[model samples]
Target: MINITLPDGSVKQVSKGSNALDLARQISEGLARNVLAAKVNGKVIDATLPLYEDAHLTLLTWNDPEGKSTMWHSSAHLMAEAIELLYPGVKFGIGPDIENGFYYDIDFCDYDISEKDFSKIEKKILELAKEKQTYQRKEVSKADALDYFSKKGDEYKLELIQDLEDGQITFYKSGQFTDLCRGPHIPNTGFIKAVKLTKVAGAYWRGDENRKQLTRIYGITFPKKKELTAYLEMLEEAKKRDHRVLGKELGLFTFSQKVGLGLPLWLPRGAVLREQLEQYLKRVQKEAGYEPVITPHIGNVNLYKTSGHYQKYGEESFKPIKTPVEGEEFFLKPMNCPHHCEIFNSSPHSYKELPIRYAEFGTVYRYEQSGELHGLTRVRGFTQDDAHIFCTPDQIKSEFNGVIDIVQQIFTAFNFNDVIIQISLRDPQHPEKYIGSDENWEKAENAIKEVAEERGLNAIVEYGEAAFYGPKMDFMVRDAIGRKWQLGTIQVDYNLPERFDLTYIGADNEKHRPVMIHRAPFGSMERFVAVLIEHCGGNFPLWLSPDQAIILPISEKYQNYAEKVLLLLKKHEIRTVIDDRSEKTGRKIRDAELKKIPYMLIVGEKEEASGSVSVRKHGEGDLGTFSIEDFAQKINSEVNKLINY
Candidate 1:
């Protein structure tokens, strides 16, 4: 008998050859029926894979992320089968499950596919899914795999197999379709009761732009039709909340092909919104013992080389700018931490002066592919509300907790109550992919996990998701429409200090390395503002709105009184504007509503003399009339409630 430890810490003695499905059966039949996959000693595998030794097993159902991934992966195979049936002689590149769904890249020679074919493909997928074909995994030798695909005249599979070792190659076969895969697939296709092909796009063979562009089909699947229907509804809502659509509607930001793709031009209104967000964080950072600093947009090439960024991301970075002087090269700064590291190294320090927090709204540039660019969310240039805390190793946890508090405060103020925390760690198998000593890596990972637990955060741990330098914690906020966006991050690094040879004198008068804590509550000004616009549906909170209130004149008669009201509101520091255009009151109101202005103050002939203004709230309709002072006081109170320094 071998020992199998369940997630709840229960140890069960089972036969040596018992598979994960057998273990689930021992637990409960209902659990067995729901089990889509299993995690064996942290590695996800088929539920039917037999275990012959002591192992830690976690049975995965639809509720677990791994289970969902397995289901989606199986759905991809099912999709491939459907696509093959619909289009014969189609060669596939890769089909993997993504965050929301799965996508398959296919080289359909002389064949055309578009959104119009989505229904037929989705129908085919569902029809195959009902067939209840079991996904059977089979290991194949490199030569055998080559023979299989070569006989089928698929050069794509041949190219893939060329890099894979003989013993490591595996193929998964379901129904009449078979494909090479390293999988933890669902038990059967029947689990995918509903399927939807979401989009069709063009992708390079291996994401290399120079390679042949293939047709990429994106899709999503669910175990229940009702769930699929709800997901479609959410997709519709997400479309309405799309930042690109809202940005144009509210005149927040814009992109110009002439200026360049993936670069945003912040209009006046958008600039005001960004400035308000920055000022809000600036105030919070001041209270939290942070000193603001500024850095240049370009840095010496040697700076990145010394930070090891050049070694890892040199090719991805924009080519260095050359100068008249030989060997003089500079680059648009890709990150802020390296410059901050130089700042810390500028002077000597002692343990007493530890935890030096350097904050900057630093703008940086990256060379993002045009296809990947999406409004402000994925941009070539953006400013990060970045900071680096240089502290003693003993102070890491405390500093991390402090950063968490600030993040929570900012999210709460922005009404992002549904926050999901994710702890990303390095992959153990690929130790060379990361820098820093094993001891420091352990220290950083544990510090993050402990702080997350102590703070009682709703956090999930994911491996192989860490920055190449260190482990980190990221906060994903769900907007009003239930779409999640990564907003905040705190990374613990021990590599940079060692790279820069930064030191601080301890109580023993011995030189010690200061641990570095890199954090950004708002990942970037552009992305944060974009998310904010969508989250609030452009009806920004009183404190953050670019134009909180608009003064409307019933006619040319009350224009003076409208100006008077606006002056008073501006005196009270409310962001108010006057719609003095010679248009009907209804048209003005409709325009203001479309702009998502929070409040509209209408002054007519009677109100101009009575010293009162008619008030209307956006989306909520009229809130009756109030004296100018009363309205100003009400707006001030609401703003103060949302933003308190």
Candidate 2:
């Protein structure tokens, strides 16, 4: 007998060859029926894989992310089988499960596929799924794998096999289809009761633009038809709230081919919104004892080399700018931390001034592919609400907690109550992918974990998602339509200070390295504003709205009173504007509502003589007429209510 430790810390004595499914059955019949996969010693594997030694096992069901991945992965195979049946001689590339669903890249020789064919393809997938074909995993040698794909004339799989080791090769067979894969798949195709092919796009082989572009089919699946129906409904709602569509409709931002692709051009209204967000964060940072700083948009190549960014991300950065001086080159800054590192090195520091916070709304440029760009969310150039905190190692936890408080305050003020935190750590198998001592990495990771636990955050830990220099905590927030977006990040680094040779004088007169904490609550001004536009549906909170109130005149007779009301509201620091156009009161109200103005103050014959104004809230009906002072007080109070941090 061997010992198997369950997630709840129960040790069970079972036969050495017992599989995860057997253990699940031992636990409960209900659990066994729901088990889709298993996490064995932190590695996800097939539930049917035999376990021969003592191990830690966690049974994964539909509620677990790993289980969902396994289901989606199996769904991808179902999709591939359907595609092969629909279009013979179609060569496959990669088909992996993504955050929402699965996508397969296929080189369809002289075949055309589009969204119009989605229904037929989805029907085929469901038909195959009902066959209840078990997903059979077979280990094969590299020579045999090559022979199999070579006989099928699939050069893609042949090329993939070239880089893989012989002994570790495996293939999964489902129904009448077989594919080369190292997989932990669902038990059978029957688990995917519902299927939907979401979209069709073009992708280059291996992500290399020079290679042949293949047709990429994206899809999603569910175990229940009701769940699939609900998901489709959510997709419809998401389409209505898509940031690209809303951004254009609300005149928030735009893109111009002449200006360049992946670069966002902020219109007047969008600029105002961006400025308001910056001002709000500026006030919060000031209160948190942060000092504002500015840095150049480009830096010398050597600066990045010394900071270690050039070694890790040099190719992904914009092409270097060559100068008249021989061999002198500069790059559009890919990150702001390096410049901040140089700033810290500019002067000597003592223990009393140990923690120094530098904040910047720094604009950085990256070389994002045109196909990957999506409005302001993914852009070539964007401004980061970035800040770095330099403190002693002993102060890392408190500083992290402080940063968390700031992030929570910002989210709460913006009415983002549904926030999820993710802790990202380095992959242990690939230590060379990261920089920093093991001791420092452990300390930094532990500090973030402790702080998150102490603060009682809804946090999940993910390995192999960390930055090259450090581990990070990221915030994923759901918008009004339940579409999740990554908005905030906090990272701890012990590498940059050492690279820059930064030092601080301790109380004992000994020199010590200061630990670096990098954070960006907004991630970037462009992306945050885009998410905010979709979250509030362009009906911004009063304080953040570009035009807090609009004064409307019933006729030419009451134009003077409308102007006076606008001036009175402006004098009280409310962003007020007057619609002086000679249009009907109903037309003016409709226009103001379309513009998403928070409030509309109407002036007519009676209001002109009475020296009062009629107030109407956007999306909500009128709140009654009041004097200009009372209206200003009301607006102030409402704005305060929304902005109380």
Candidate 3:
């Protein structure tokens, strides 16, 4: 008998070979039926994998994200199995689970695949799923793996095998299909009740443009048919809310060939929106005792080398610029921290002033592949709401707690109440992937976790997701349509200070190293604004709206009244605009509504007599007439409520 520790702190004495499925059955048959996978120690694995020694185990069900990922990954195998049956002699490339679903790349030698083939493929997938074929895993030697794929004439599989080590190889077989994978799959194909092949696209082999292009089939699966139906409906709604489409329709931002790809041009309205967001944060940062600073767009190449960013990210950075001063090369700044480090080095400091905070809205550049660039979300140029806090070891916790408060404050204003927090740490198995001393890493990681616990944040810990220089805390927020996005992040670093040789005189009059906290509540201005547009469907909050209200004259005779109302709104510090077009009242209102203006003030002969204006709210009918002062007061009340934080 061996000791197995369950998640609830219970120790069970079971046979050494007992699997997670067996343990779940012992607890309750219902749990066993729902168990899709299990987390053994810290790694996720199949529920059917046998235990060889004492271990810690947590059974994963459909409700868990890992469990859902396992199911989706297994569904990809099921789809491939169906394709293999329907069209023999088809070679497989790679199949992976994406954010929404699973997709498989296939090298169809002589068979043509397109959208017309999706229905039959989806039907065949459901048929194979009902057969309840068990997914089996097998550990194979490198030689055996090569021989198997070699006989099948699959160069893709052989190429993948070449990079992996001998003892780490594993293959999973489901139904009549077998593939090379390092997998934690669902128990059987029966877990998938509904299947949909969403689209067919072209993808180069291994994402290399020089390689042969293959047909990539995208798909999704659900445990219940009703869930699949709901997902399909959400997909339709998401299409309507897609940021790229909404950004263009709403005139927020755009890209041009002359301006270059992946670099967005903020239109007048979008520029105002971006400035408002920046001013909001600037106000909050000022209140938090942060000093604003600015840095140039380029930095000496040696600056990044000292901060260790160049060594880790040099390949992804643009080629360095050589100056007339030979051997003095500069690169468009890829990060702001290195320049900030030099700023700290410029002034000597003592422990009495340990926690010095500097903030900047710094623009950084990266070399992103043209294929990977989406709208503003995945851009080559972006500005970070970046800040760095240099604090003593004893002050680390309080500074971290304050950063959390800022993130919470930002979320409150945006009404983003649905947030998932994650504490990301380095992988213990791969120590070489990270920098910094073990002692410093332990201190930084402990400071973050302890602060989170003290603040009562139920943050999940994920290993192998940390930055190379430090551990980080990431905020994953769900948008209006239930899509998850990583918005804000806070990182604790001990490596950069040491690399830059930064120090402060301690209270004991001895030189000591200071801990660095790197934070960005908005992550990036472009990405945040993009998400905000999609979240509210282009109907912005009053304070952030491009045009708070538009004054429409009922007729050419009432133009004077409309102009008077607009002046009064502007005097009240409202973002007001005038619509003096020759169109009728109805056309003006319709145009204003389509522009997503928050309020429309209609001025006519009645307003000219009563000195009052009729107000119409966007997405709603008329809000009745009010004096100009009263309307401004109403707008002020709503905007003040949102900005009170």
**What's the TM-score of each model vs. the native?**
0.82, 0.83, 0.83
Could you tell me which residue pairs clash in candidate 3? none
Highest TM-score: give the candidate number. Answer: 3
Q: How many clashes show up per model?
A: 0, 0, 0
Off by over 4 Å in 2: 1-71, 93-96, 126-175, 178-194, 202-214, 222-230, 310-316, 319-330, 428-434
- Model 3 C-alpha lDDT per residue in residues 244-353, reported as the tens digit of each score: 98888878889999989899999998999999999999999999989999999999988988987788888888999888867688989988988899999998999998
Q: Write the per-residue lDDT of candidate 1 for residues 448-554, one digit (tens) a residue.
A: 88988877888999999998878999999999977789999999888899999999999999999999999999999998988997898777897888899999999
Model 3 superposed RMSD (Cα): 5.0
Q: Which digits, one per residue and each the tens of the lDDT, describe model 2 over residues 1-645?
A: 889998899998889898999998998998898889999999999998999999999999989999999999989988999999999989999999999889999999988888998998999998898898888999999999999999999899999999999899999999889999999998788889888888899999999999999899999998889999999998887777777887888787899999998989888878888898999899999999999999999999999999888988898788899888797999999889999999999999997997899999999999998778887889999999999999988888899999998999999998898998999998988988888878878888889899888889889999999988899999999877777889999998888999999899999999989999999999999999888878987778889888889999888888778888878888999998889898988899999999889999988987888889999999897988898899999989988888895
Worst 10 residues of 1 by lDDT: 536-545
Could you tell me the C-alpha RMSD of candidate 1 in Å?
5.0
What lDDT, from 0 to 1, does candidate 2 have? 0.90
Please say which candidate is ahead in lDDT: 1 or 2: 1
Q: Which ten residues in a row have the lowest lDDT in candidate 2?
A: 234-243
- Residue 49's lDDT within candidate 1 is 86
On the 0 to 100 scale, the lDDT of residue 453 in model 2 is: 88
